[model samples]
Target: MGRVVAIANQKGGVGKTTTAVNLGASLAVAEQRVLLIDLDPQGNASTGVGCAPGSVVRSSYQVLLGEVAVEDAVLETELPHLHVIPSTPDLAAAERELFGDEDWATRFRDAIASIRMQYDFILVDCPPSLGTLTINALTAADLVVVPLQCEYYALEGLSQLTNTIERVRNGLNPGLTIHGVVLTMFDPRNNLANDVAAEVRRHFHVYETVIPRNIRLAEAPSHGKPVILYDAASRGSYQYLNLAREILDALPIQAA
Candidate 1:
C-alpha cells in the first residue's frame, strides 16, 4: 500500500504547501506515482501543480463530505506521475458543514481507503490551524512531515503540534508517527536563521537537507508550476529533489 504523509505545520508561512507541491513533483520525476490532496482551503497546492481550484468539477470539499468518490476527484497534473485533488474556498467551511457528526474526523480516512494502493505516496497539504480539517488529515495519514520555518516564533508552536500528534496517535490513528521535520526559508547570512536551524536539528528528527529562501520557490506557484518544472536549475528545485530522495530512503513500505 502507499504511504500517506501529511505535510503539516499549524504555523502559517512555514512552507507547508511549498514542500507538498515541490516534493510531490520531485517524487513524480523519480518515477513514483504520487497523489497530492489540497486540504488547505487556499487551493495554492492546486495552483502550484497547474490545476487551479475552480477549474476542477470535483474537489476535496465534495470528497470530504462523501458526495464524491476519491478516485473521481483526482485530477491529472502537468507532471506525469503526480495527480491532485484540488480544494475550493468553500472547503474552509467544511467544519461547519460536518458539525455534530460523530464521524467528522474520519471522513477523509474512509474516503481514501478504496484508492490507497494506486500510488506510491499520497500527500495532504494541511491548513495552518488545529481545526476539523487538520484533524481529519492527521487521522488519515500514516506519517506526518512537518515544515518548520526558520523563525524564533516557530519553535514555540512545535511542542503544541507534537502534543496534538500524540493525542491523535492515542485516540484517532494509533499508527501515526512523525516521519521527520524539514527546515524551510533558511538564510545563511542571518545569524537567527542559522541558530534556529541548528536548534531545530538538535531537537527534532530533521532532514539533513535544508530548503533555502529561494526566489524561484516563491515565483513558481504564481506561474502555476512547481519549482522543479518552472526552473530545474534553481536552488529550490535541487534541494527538493534531494529531499525527495532522502524521504524515499527512510520510508519502508508495508501492506495496508
Candidate 2:
C-alpha cells in the first residue's frame, strides 16, 4: 500500500507546495514511484512539476466533484517515476460544491483508494486554509507533513491547524498523524530563524533537513522544474534531496 502524505499548512508562503513538488520528484529520483496531488487551487505543485494548471482540461476539480476517476485525471510528469493529479483555479469553488453532502469529507479518500497500490507515495499539496478541501485532504492522508517557515510568526495559527487535524483524526481518519514538520526558508545569518526553528523542534517532530532560503528554490517553479533539475548543485536541491531521504527512512513501511 502507498503512504498518502498530505503536505499542508494553513499558513501561506511556507513552502508547502514546494515541499510537495520537490520531495515527490526526489523520491522518484530515488527509484520510488510517486504521485503528487495538487489539491491547492493555485496548482503550484502541478506547475512546479511542469504541468500547466490553466491548460489542464481534467484536473483535481473534476476528481473532487466525482466527474471523473482519479486515474483519468493523473498526468505523467517528465520524471519517469513521478506523476501528478493537477488542480485548477476552479477548485476554489470546491467547498461550495461539496456543501451539505454527508460524505463530503471522504470524497478525496475514495477517489484515491483504487489507485493506492500503484505508487509508493502519494503526496497531496493542500490549499492554505482549514476549509472543506483541506478537510478532505486530511481525511484522505495517512500522514501529514507540515512545512513551517522559520520566522517570528511561524507558530501563528499552528494551534488551529493542529486542532483541525485532531478533529479529523477523531472523527474521520483515525490513522492520520503528523509525520514530521519541515523547517523551510531558513537564513542562518538571522538569529530569529534559529530561535524559531528551535521553538518548532521543541513542540513537534522536526525534520533534520533545514531548507535554506535560496534563489534557485524560488526560481525553479517559474521554469517548470524542481530545484534538483534546475540547479543540481544548489543548496535548495541538496536540502530537498536530504529531506526525501529523511522522509523515506522515517516511513514505517519498506520502500517498494
Residue by residue across 168-198, what tens digits does model 2's lDDT show?
A: 9999999999989998888888899888888
TM-scores of all candidate predictions against the true structure: 0.97, 0.97
RMSD of each: 1.2, 1.2
User: For model 1, what is the alpha-carbon lDDT of residue 79?
Assistant: 88
In model 2, how large is the Cα lDDT of residue 176? 95
> How many backbone collisions does model 1 have?
0
Best by lDDT: 1
Mark the regions of model 2 whose C-alpha exceeds 4 Å error after superposition.
254-256
lDDT for model 2, on a 0 to 1 scale? 0.91
CA deviation > 4 Å runs, candidate 1: 253-256
